[model samples]
Target: MKIKSAEFARGVTGNDYSTQDNLPQIAFLGRSNAGKSSVINSLTGRKNLVHSSKTPGKTIEANFFCINNLFYLLDFPGYGFAMRGVQERNKMVKRIFWYLEFTNARPKVIFLIIDAKVGLTDLDLEMLEIIKQNNHKVVIVANKVDKLPQTKRKDKILSIVSQAKGLEVLEYSAKTHEGKENIFKIIEDLVK
Candidate 1:
């Protein structure tokens, strides 16, 4: 599953281009500042590929990146950013829901990224429930593992796994590229 080519396809706020594309989509979803963009950049091994921001909730639309010309890596706007206006937050949430429930571009799998130290927030749990209700295949990615001490990493991952119920939780570090290969493998399987 080596990435031979990756490029920004488009960003959509509604059912236009997104629904028209038949390419298999791999969705990346998470809370604001959860490192979704960073993980994408890390996986592609291209710095600035996704343009991670220091500010939370900067992504306003679903951005699609074409991967290896085989499928699309959909980078969705982060959810539950308290700093944003209530109306804006709600709009973003509704957009995500629309994509999940109504769009024709069904993702092959959803990668729910989370901060390893923060574990699963209430918002994440809610999102997971909705995603499951929609019957989408999902994988939980515990990003920023490098921030935690080596001794605490396993315990944190275990805690996340427990909280995630039976869902697969992959320990990841966008900074160190740990668990990148495993994620690639999952993507490979799904895209195939």
Candidate 2:
């Protein structure tokens, strides 16, 4: 799908709110600083379309972006940040669950981002479990893959896929636009 235009539509905080016109949505999920924002920006061909934070736990809301007037790309708040207190952490998790389970217009596909260098952390697995429980379609994305050598890329991807239980896995380097087509192709298939 050619990204003719991508723009920020709105930011959502709670699940009680209504979604955007019942369009097919593909939400981005990942830990803080895991390159969720970067991947969104890269996929839409709009640099800085999504705000990436140097400090983790900054995006406390679920942001929605409209892509080429075709579908909605929801940018969910990051999980697994250390600075958050227990209460804040719980709230974040609750919000994530609410969006995944309670929302009526469930996402067509979920782009679960993970840091390529770190591989799959325990938090990532937990998130995947929640996605499975909610019966949401997921695509395990290993972000920041540009940091790894070309030869190691396939190996790392294979390892991550082996670790994940069911979701289809794809590697993306937001910095270099590597694997951009693969990600979009998956999304296109899901949305269509």
Candidate 3:
């Protein structure tokens, strides 16, 4: 789908915050530095529409962006960062869960991004379990494939697909815009 217009709606910390006019949503979930922002920017063809950082855990809020005035792209804060103290980290984790659990608005699909170079981590597996339990339709996007060796890409993709069971897995690189067509096609099918 060609993005006629795109812009950040707001950054929210909790579910109590009201959303804009009703629209279908495609949510993103991943650990810090997993390239969530970059992927969003690339998909919307809006360079730097969402701020990205080299530092992990830079996105602390669940930001929403409207796409073509048709649906929302919810950019959630990345988890699994060690910079915060135990209490702070625990609080953030709780808030994230609260938002997911309490949201009345269901998303069309949830994109769970995994860093291609790193494969899957323990935290990622844990989050995957949660997403699966919720019965949310998920599309696993293995990000940063541009950093991986060509030989390893196929193996890594297979590994992710195996781990994800029935969910479709797509390799992606925000830097090079690789695998964007497949990703968008899946989104269109899901949200249409």
Candidate 4:
């Protein structure tokens, strides 16, 4: 799971997708500002591979990254943000759904990232249902665990798990590098 080399492939929006090579894709998805970029950066040991924006809803495109020349890593636009206008949000929504539901290069696995401290949201639950409906294998990543105090950590994780319906949940912290290797291993297994 050690990533020898990684490169940005493309940024996709609207009805478009990344160039077709049939590389097994692992998609990362979550709520806006849910730490999707940070988790990818942390997992790959590439600090800036994915941009961690200070502004919510900044990542409006689906970014594709070639991982180790072995597979593709997809950074999907975060859902459930209110910062965008109706038309813009509709486009984003359509783009993401189209990629997930209609793309030729379906992801081998979906990393559903959630803010650990914030626990799970109704939207996240909806995404989980979508993953199930599509029969896509998913790994729920609870990121930003570094922000949770020790005493509340267990309860917070439990809260996230309660909503996951028995899907595997990994507690993670980009700042602390916690659960990074485990995430990488999962991706490697899926792609290989």
Worst 10 contiguous positions by lDDT, candidate 3: 13-22
lDDT of 2 at 138: 88
Per-candidate TM vs. native?
A: 0.96, 0.93, 0.94, 0.94
> After best superposition, candidate 1 residue 78: deviation in angstroms?
0.5
Model 1 C-alpha lDDT per residue in residues 1-192, reported as the tens digit of each score? 788999998989877545355889999999999999999999999998898999998788889899898899888899999788888898888888888888777888999999999999999998999899999999999999999998998898899999999999999999999999999999898877
Residues 4-121, model 2: lDDT tens digits: 8888888887665365466789989998889888889888888889888788886788888988778899887888886888788878888998888888888898989999888889
Winner by TM-score between candidate 3 and candidate 1: 1
Best by lDDT: 1
- Estimate the TM-score for candidate 4: 0.94
Clash count, one per candidate: 0, 0, 0, 0
Per-residue alpha-carbon lDDT of candidate 3 for residues 73-176, written as tens digits (9 for 90 to 100): 98888888878776767776777676556677777788888898787788888877877777778888999999988888788888877877777888899999
TM-score of 3: 0.94
Candidate 2, residue 173: Cα displacement in angstroms equals 0.3
Give the clashing residue pairs of candidate 3, or none: none
Cα lDDT of candidate 1 equals 0.90
Ranking by TM-score: 1, 4, 3, 2
lDDT of 4 at 66: 89
User: Residue 19: error of model 1 in Å?
Assistant: 5.6
Give candidate 1's total backbone clashes.
0
lDDT per model, in order? Answer: 0.90, 0.84, 0.83, 0.84
